[model samples]
Target: MAAQGDNRPIGVFDSGIGGLTVARSIATSLPHESIYYVGDTKRCPYGVRSESEVRSFVLQAGRWLAAHDIKIMIIACNTATAAGLKIAQQMLPVPVIGVIAPGARAAINSTRTRKVGVLATPLTVRTGAYTRAIRDLDAGVSVYGCPAPSFVEIVENELATGAHLQERWLQDGDVFDTPENREEVARTLGPILEPGIGIDTVVLGCTHFPLLVNPIRHALGEGVRVVSSAEETTRELTDILVRREQLAEDDVVPEHRFATTSDNIAEFAAAGSFIFGQPLKSIEHISLDELDRY
Candidate 1:
């Protein structure tokens, strides 16, 4: 007799709506599985927070999700992963995965010139996680870390609003293509885009970065390949589930649940809907106090 499939939902958490990128990819890759996503929007942009603070927040989120009976937990924020992955793996009851290693692996595979650039949060770059992961995979390859501190703000505050929510921005009049945004992106990415860099591939080290891919690609030019861990991370999740016989059965009808720490559910829903590529019918607001109880 074959083993029965596990129907428990996957838990994914990020500093803000950025994790929806990873969650969306997982939903597409594993249609039968449900997902429980937690976005700590109130304390978002974890990129700037101290490592200790980020780790504490990550654990709180992980514990809260684990308490809800999730089979696996994914730290979808690059900063959270860099700061808390090891400790989360030690403390969480279920399997815990983060975006960093998978993203580093994807960057390594995408680079033809063996010179890769990483665009991530200040904390993520400061941690040297990507450089360590990439070099561990291939010591011959060179990894350059570039901190784009304002990129997260651009995604969460700018792109998630106004015309961007309508999907029109994705068409010819991309929001990232605006003069102001173009100048900002160019300025922020100048270090990596420098001629001497000679990087053939760049990794979107933060989940939020993928949403700004159009502008990032434009700045990097046609010669550079951009990589995100959304697909690679989902692949790792699939393999883990298969090995543990926890893959959801084909007959399972998946349900996705969204929760946010933000006080305004409407705004979170709107931004989330845009990021998740679907209408978010319901979203629960979770407070830091409530999360602390877990």
Candidate 2:
């Protein structure tokens, strides 16, 4: 007789809906596993917040998810991961996975020049998590950490305005395709694109960065390779599940549930649907005080 598979849902949390990119990748990679995602949108843009604040926020979200009986948890925000991953792992009941290490490993594998550029939130860059992770993996690699403090706001603004609702926006191009947006992205990305940097691989350190990939790619030019930790993180999740025999059974149907700390649940659903590549059937508005009870 074969060992039974665990059917509990995987928990994923981020500062905002940006983490949907990681949740989407997990759903695609592990179709049989269910997912419970929490987005703390009420106090988003964790990149600009203090390290202690980000850590506190990460724990509140993690504890809430853990109380819901999730099998595992993934800290989908790069800033949160940088600030709170170790403590979350120690405090949470389930296994905790962070995006930075996987992203660093992926960047290392993709870089041919051994010079990798990391575009992330201000706090993430300040923490030097990606730089540390990359160098720890391979001391020969040169890591450049660039702060893109405006990128998250750009993504959140688009999501708030229902830009994601337009089929053309989703299928054809995003807000970054506009001349104004293009200029903004280019200017913000100037440091990494400098001739002296000569990086062949660029890591999207924040989950939100993936939504702006088209514009980012345009700015970086054709020679640079863009990498997102979403896929690599999902791969790590799969390996852990397989080792623990916790992979959802083939016969089990997968269900996805979403929650947000924002008052505007509708906006979250709309943006989440766009990022998740499917209409979100279940979405609930959660409160910070409620999460504290967990």
Candidate 3:
């Protein structure tokens, strides 16, 4: 722990359980720290909601993190981050970070052809967060946005993969990241990606897109580097904590605190264990009836 201040836990939140991807990355990148994660699974898809709704939801959930004495607050959903981060930063005292800036920075630094294709949630694409983040680096970088709604849905419902999990949830391929459907999605998305842009890299700006990495790589063809916001976002969080002198001194057998506002927590935990590459240390359910309390 830093000598100057309290080494309270870090808090991570998302519209749904997909933020576990970010949390999982954080576990590896900052093993010494304790983390509290909240999944707003009740309103799982914030992508189509109005900005006001997203902001309010983030405020409610992020405030819960604050109550937990979190030293840092990470908005793990790209859509929520796009709509809520600016306002959340103003309202919160801690160092607030989001996946967009880090992911964008990574793409800008990695792209050889200056043409970057971004795969994110519908709302993130609608808001042009990735485009703005990339353009902030250099206006000439041809940044394209592709909305992968099904990817988020698959994750929200926890239908990722595995024999037991597959039996638990109905197995039907979606609009993206499916073996049968990926090529078609690519064909449709590829046209929007102008060849003149010389796109040689694609940014998986949405955390859920990380699960789609292999399929996306196959669809985008060879040589296109697929960068997930997961690793880059984790690196950013680590740097921010270190810069702020908030990193824990030693690994505390790193505990994962999972809280969800949905009835499907069992499914999420199963999915998260796979993503975290470890079993959950704890799981708490936020009963829908307790909405007003939270």
Ranking by lDDT: 2, 1, 3
Q: Which segments of model 2 are wrong by more than 4 Å?
A: 1-4, 168-172
Model 1 spans with C-alpha error above 4 angstroms: 1-4, 159-164, 167-172
> Model 3: per-residue lDDT, tens digit, 176-246?
35555566456646654666666888888677767666567777777778886778888888777767777
TM-score of each: 0.96, 0.96, 0.88
lDDT of 1 by residue, 189-230 (tens): 888777777999999999998878888888888889999999
- Candidate 1's TM-score reads 0.96
Backbone clashes for every candidate come to: 0, 0, 1
Alpha-carbon lDDT, every model = 0.89, 0.90, 0.77
C-alpha-based local distance difference test score of model 2 = 0.90
**Model 1: C-alpha RMSD to truth?**
1.8
- Residue 279 of model 3 has an lDDT of 78
The residue-by-residue lDDT of candidate 2 on 98-169, one tens digit each, is 999999999988999999999999999999999999999999999888899899998888788654456667
